[model samples]
Target chain A: MPAANGNNAGILKSGHDARLLSRSNKCGNTSGLAPGYVQTNLIVLPSRYASDFRLLCARNTVPCPLVAESATPGHWGKIKSHLLGIDGETLAKGLDIRRDAPKYNVYVDGKLHRQDCEDIVTEWTDDHVAFLIGCSFSFETALADAGLTPTHTARGRNVPMYRTTLPLCAAGVFRDSTYVVSMRSYPASEVERVRDITRPFASTHGEPVAWGWDALERLGIRDIDSPQWGDAPLAKIDGKPLSSFKNNEAEVPVFWGCGVTPQEAVMRANLEGVVMAHSPGHMILLDTLDVETIRKF
Target chain B: MPAANGNNAGILKSGHDARLLSRSNKCGNTSGLAPGYVQTNLIVLPSRYASDFRLLCARNTVPCPLVAESATPGHWGKIKSHLLGIDGETLAKGLDIRRDAPKYNVYVDGKLHRQDCEDIVTEWTDDHVAFLIGCSFSFETALADAGLTPTHTARGRNVPMYRTTLPLCAAGVFRDSTYVVSMRSYPASEVERVRDITRPFASTHGEPVAWGWDALERLGIRDIDSPQWGDAPLAKIDGKPLSSFKNNEAEVPVFWGCGVTPQEAVMRANLEGVVMAHSPGHMILLDTLDVETIRKF
Candidate 1:
């Protein structure tokens, strides 16, 4: 049982438990809320963009894995998911997506319209579709269990994210979107063990795509000290090839496909519709489907 | 030593060994010619499209892993490669790109201009950049050693390829590009073994992206009986959901990122520039690099 400290109950037993927590603590991060379930990043958009958005997840499976998507437009309550061959685990039948998540960030024409909304029930319409993307938090426990806890989590900070030179496979209207990767630094010796632990968790951004100092330069990331989102890694890089990091030169940076990749895509596309996403670190946890079952092998 | 049957030295000691054979046996497929070497797909285009094409490879790393790339506009001969951090293992010095490949397919304005050309010397220009992409053949020996030989290879046929509905992350001027996948069928029980063996070979198209019947519908591949290129798999299908196969229904379909993906992208982009590629199954093999050294882990 996870610490449902703010929950009416002492611990979370299911996805609804986290949603119940969300109702009271509307702006809290869902990082450690649900212990044995799926936590997902949310993207609710107009039906017209749904097809293209769905295609985006299909092509870029690592960054935008589909956990539970509405079978049709406006079926937010029943985001039926049958991913990686799990028999259609419906998320708490009639689990209204608009009010279930902890926080919402609404966008209009690709720019940030509003942030920290408790529920977007007023924003719901028959024309809008909701997509539930697998979140990296779902696999953090697995890493921690394997004694490979991420540096950010150990430091009690959000994982740093950077916009990469790598482009997302563009779907209809979602053109020219650069990939955003979340960064975590590990000891050089622990990097391979970290990758091996997370590779099977395909539902989440499975494995680190880039590692070490050279990879940042390769991915076109100009700086290691500054990041696009969250807290930066504890590193004092000098120049082109990162040789010095804090006092430990053995600290290597690892990057994984980020769920924010979709948000960045929607931001760039700037589509003419209300796009709703979860505030960073705030996510919707689903019941029945444990992260353990979401294996590639 | 691989069968450099037409080689003056009768064995392949370096990447140039295959090029020597390419000069005389201009139309032979380089599949089994250079064992223990990296075999690559060729893509030569005007320098203007090189940046976007590079981005395409960076974004879609699985389908288009970068083994070696032309650093400048016309450094085709000295294709300096430092991929996966091998400390710049340059291929055979002055290995002329124009006349080395076994066969070339030149496209003008995205239409097939010529086929089965011995050399593309006339097509070379100061503005052309040659991109050498990692090919799946670089790992076929690994698969074969693991006893997971692809059905097509065992039957002496080219691997079947299909244009998937999944779109490529569109780069500049390369809009609305769909992904193309190469298919191989295997016994259902051996699928996991196949994935484990190939997952580390990141230089080549690494693991199977999709497998089983459901994956076809998910990728929007309608017909399994007919493929866009190469020979169709040993399959028998009737409708939407594929359940039946050639007697042994235990045979499951496995798909990897095809080198043909770039060709499909170039074909769809239909740019106003000359484009060149190796014919299917024909590739350039490089020395000093083995498929084993190109591990992700």
Candidate 2:
């Protein structure tokens, strides 16, 4: 993560402050971190669950791309970057996963308990394995680059994530209910380019699976004024409500695969003890750039 | 391979004729059969060489992409296409590996001996493995789709291929050697788009490694008239010599990973007996389409 205090402020400061708050057990949610670097959702499990988890990732690669799996079981510290020449450095060095995350949630017997990162070190075992799944930071970056601001990012609030009726492919015990997606609204004309841009970033989520105003209604979302995750969009520009573009027409909404999908899978699997993950915004900054990773795909 | 000589005579007859020619030792080469479908280059090796060969493909996937590897050694008839759904039928069904090729060259103990496909199959043992690799037919399709005329295709000739000084990454017993590339030309303005278009088709040679007329001359070829593998361009179009549009405006000639590289590797390894490949152009027609395979990447 980039430094927050001195010359860097605003967006960059938020990342630094988040890291500091996370280190102090103050801010556990990573909705705000380094502005440019990617943030990933993490899943840690035992080797016994590794193969099944691998299968789950393979089956639902769009949602749970296995960006970097531990080279071997029990070595949570060694995350290999797929790009050659950069490996061996621990992701924990610059950002401590346990301390840097704003909040750490513990799942024991599939029940959730809020815990600080330091409290869970005793739970780390030789049998444990860690997986870093791609997150939506880049997608958000893409959206922002296209001049379509995500409401959550703009308001400094967590992006609203919802569990959908879409069922994920089951791999062993690691079965996830459909998908949990992040919604953003854009004008109809911009949807095609968004879809085109996101298509190459398949590991990140790929293209939008559904787009339209009625999508929220179809998903049984009743209230538009109050969101389950983040603040609702500010006033609509012009007469039309802010809509995600679909086929050159302004769509009422656009939905994309979210990082929470994998987290939900890990939770549903009901593994014993605890599973570790990066709290939302914080991520393992890879030595290789996004373009190189994209090229590998 | 699709059975020709039926109602789809215009296209089917040419395929049927090619197949018939294979039976009588008159097929010449399988280059132009069933024009639109993917054509493959073939490489056969003993099981002992399989792992090394697999590594060779992995290390230098561009030229020697392992489209299909025999499930188990010596089961030549059990081939499967990696990108395409084409199943492994006998290489001997419609075409004879030894005799069908317009020109069949054999190597024993690292020395060359020209022989027909049948002459080599007699030496086939359970230990032998066959590998089918992607070729340039798809790239040619891309060039045509881009509206750039490939001179060789328009003139009814094989695209000129050359053995260059570009060394391939070696694996195990396979030593590094300069690459062999097929060439077609387009004007300078079209080169960038051609590169952009073909870059996605990594399975079939992808982008060119070099460009410009002088680069070809630097590779020790004096006369453009004397092409190493196929006919020269028919004529200069709009002041530019009809060459590989695949090449960039940069001095380096665009070289894609050719399926022939692995064939050459297998020959260079010199395990024993005769190795069979698609009779140059007469490739096995796959159920998979080019666009579908591109989507996978």
**Best of the candidates, lDDT:** 1
Alpha-carbon error at A6 in model 1, in Å? 9.7
Weakest lDDT window of 10 consecutive positions for candidate 2 chain A: A1-10
lDDT of 2 at B5: 20
**Number of clashing residue pairs, candidate 2:** 39
iRMS for all predictions?
A: 14.4, 18.2
TM-score of chain A of each: 0.88, 0.78
Question: Candidate 2, which segments miss by more than 4 Å at Cα?
Answer: A1-10, A13-21, A24-28, A82-96, A115-119, A217-251, A279-292, B1-297
- Per-candidate chain B TM: 0.88, 0.77
Docking class of 1: incorrect
Task: Report, for every candidate in turn, its global Cα lDDT versus the true structure.
Answer: 0.72, 0.57
Which candidate ranks first by TM-score, i.e. highest? 1
| Candidate 1: residue B287 lDDT (0-100) | 66
Per-residue error for B183 in candidate 1, Å, reads 22
Any runs in candidate 1 off by more than 4 Å, and if so which?
A1-11, A25-27, A87-89, A235-249, B1-297
